[model samples]
Target: MSDRLVIENLQVSYGSGAQRVEAVAPMSLAVPAGQKLGIVGESGSGKSTLLKAVLGLIRPPGVVRADGIWLDGTDLRSLSRREFRARCGSEIAMIFQDPVNALNPAFSIRDQFRRSFRLHQPDLPRSRYTETMLRALASVSIDARDKLGRYPFEFSQGQLQRIMIALACSSPRLKVLLADEPTSSLDVTTQAQVLDLLHALQAELGFSLIIVTHNLPVVAELCDRALVMCRGEVVEDTDVISLFEQPTHDYTRHLLASMASLPRIASGAAS
Candidate 1:
């Protein structure tokens, strides 16, 4: 399959001169079309930073340098800010680490969706905004009637995460879904639900999924290929089975050992 997303010679850094910190070392990788790829690492390993660079969310005093960042066949680096925004809106989406932070405490759910619709679909009829959002909510089993007038704080974390997922994948044009620590804050059962939802969405939507997480089991279950990173560098990039059974790097082994329990995955993520 062709690559849906491509990164070549990418690096992210903070500060400058003697104080400069390389959050992500120069590296390249690709997310295969209609496949799920996992990036696993400990905290400070630059896993999340890499995702930020890809999403164009990094700002000064942070810097992003890349030879090419292509979505479909377009190099995102060549686009202007407005162009980049439009392309990302239609071709890519990101699920942040925390839904609590992603959602607003002050805005009604309707208002939240309203803002998003205005940004991505400005010409969309205002009357259909809620209708569109409601349909997305239904996809995640959220049965809302009348309208989404409730606040984010009113929902459980799990529900909030589902809502966020619904929001992220709402774009029918989405080609790549980039998720960062999606289940990090959820409890075990909630985590399972979120993972399952992502899997189902992938099957239905047929988009390439790139998940950035520290959890080995999450990667094993959901991803076909895994890339291990440490201190801003790609340590190992291989199929998930090889990543677990025969990690080529000491850091990968140490990470496996550090986990409280080794992954129980026999093969792939649970259906």
Candidate 2:
């Protein structure tokens, strides 16, 4: 199958001349249709910047330049902001790290779903909206009928994340899902649940996934291929099994070592 997404020599920079700083150095990668790819990096390692560039979310003073960012056979940079926004929920969707911040506290779950539905399918009959919302929630194993009237603060963190996933996956045109540190804030059990939900949804919906995270275990569990970033560059790109068995880059080895030592350090401290 052809690649679903291809980014070539993409670069993102802020400011100009003496004050300029590159958030994402020129880098490139591709995701095959229905593949699960993970980008692993520390904070400020340019993972988020890469995602923002792909989404056209970078504001002025922060310039995003690329040879090409192709979705299917289309180059996304050719599209205007309005045109891109129109394609957001259906063509490409993002699930942010913090679900609470992504949601409006004042709006009920039903209202949130309505806004999302309208954004992607504005001409659809209002009568079908409720059923759509219910199905979306059910896909993530949430009780939509009981929770639709509740506000954002009414649900637990895990539930909120599931809702965010539901919202992103609801559109029929959704072919790719970009998740940014989605499980970072949840407890271990909740993290596992969310990961399982993500995998199940991906299997059922057949959307390609690009997950950005610092958590190695999460990547190992959810991704087939892994890209390790350091100092705004992709230092290592390999299959998840190879990444663990033999990391080529010194930085990648260090990261793996750090993760490995954490449990021992905690045990020593406790004893």
Candidate 3:
């Protein structure tokens, strides 16, 4: 498969002087079409910052300097702000963590769905737009007629996550899904279910995925290739099975050991 996303010599930094910090090093990575790539590290390891740099969402004083970000050979960093935003929801969308915070509380599900639909299909008739919204909801196995009329609070976290996924997949312009700690908030069973859905969607939509998470089991189940990050640099890039079987980096081995030592959810929580 051809490369759908590419990054070379990517860097992100914050502040100056002795306090200066480099959040990401000269990192180079790529995601080909229909590929699932995992970036795993502990909290504050620059995983989120890396995704922000790609989206051009890094804030002031948090500088992101990169050599190239090519989407199907088109340099994304070269696009104007308007051009980038125009391409964002349509071309590359992100399913952020915390769907509750990410969504507007006041807007009903239907309204939000319609607004998102109109962003990409502005010329479609009202009836067609409604149809599209229902189709999108149904794609994620949501009951559009009943659920679309309800507020975000009416749904469970897992359901809201699926809604976010549906919204991201609504438009045909979406080529990639940037999943950041997507299943972190859910229980193991729910996490497994959502991950299954994510895998199915990737297969159905033929879109590439770049998932950032701390969950080793998630990485093992979801990703084909794994890139282990530590201290703002990629320490290991290998197949998931190989990395899990024999982690080379000291940090990678430590991470695997740490996850291995985590108590069972029920036992840990009961304590």
Tens digits of per-residue lDDT for model 2, 41-96: 88888888889889888998999989999888788888887677778788899999
Q: What is the TM-score of each candidate against the true structure?
A: 0.93, 0.93, 0.92
Global fold similarity of model 3 (TM-score)? 0.92
Better TM-score candidate (2, 3): 2
Off by over 4 Å in 1: 260-269
Instruction: Tell me the tens digit of each residue's lDDT in model 1 across 1-271.
Output: 8999999999999999999999999999888799899999888989889988988999899999999999997999999988888767567988887999899889988888887777666667988887889898999889866549899998899889998888888778889999999887888778887888899999999999999877788887888999999999999999999988998999999988886475443223346
lDDT of candidate model 1 versus the reference:
0.86
Model 2 CA deviation exceeding 4 Å by range: 263-271
On lDDT, the stronger of 2 and 3 is: 2
Q: Give the alpha-carbon lDDT of every model.
A: 0.86, 0.87, 0.84
Residues 124-157 of candidate 3: C-alpha lDDT, one tens digit per residue: 6787876788888888888778667789998899
Ordering by lDDT: 2, 1, 3
Can you rank all candidates by TM-score, best first?
1, 2, 3
Query: Looking at candidate 1, what is the lDDT of residue 13?
Result: 95
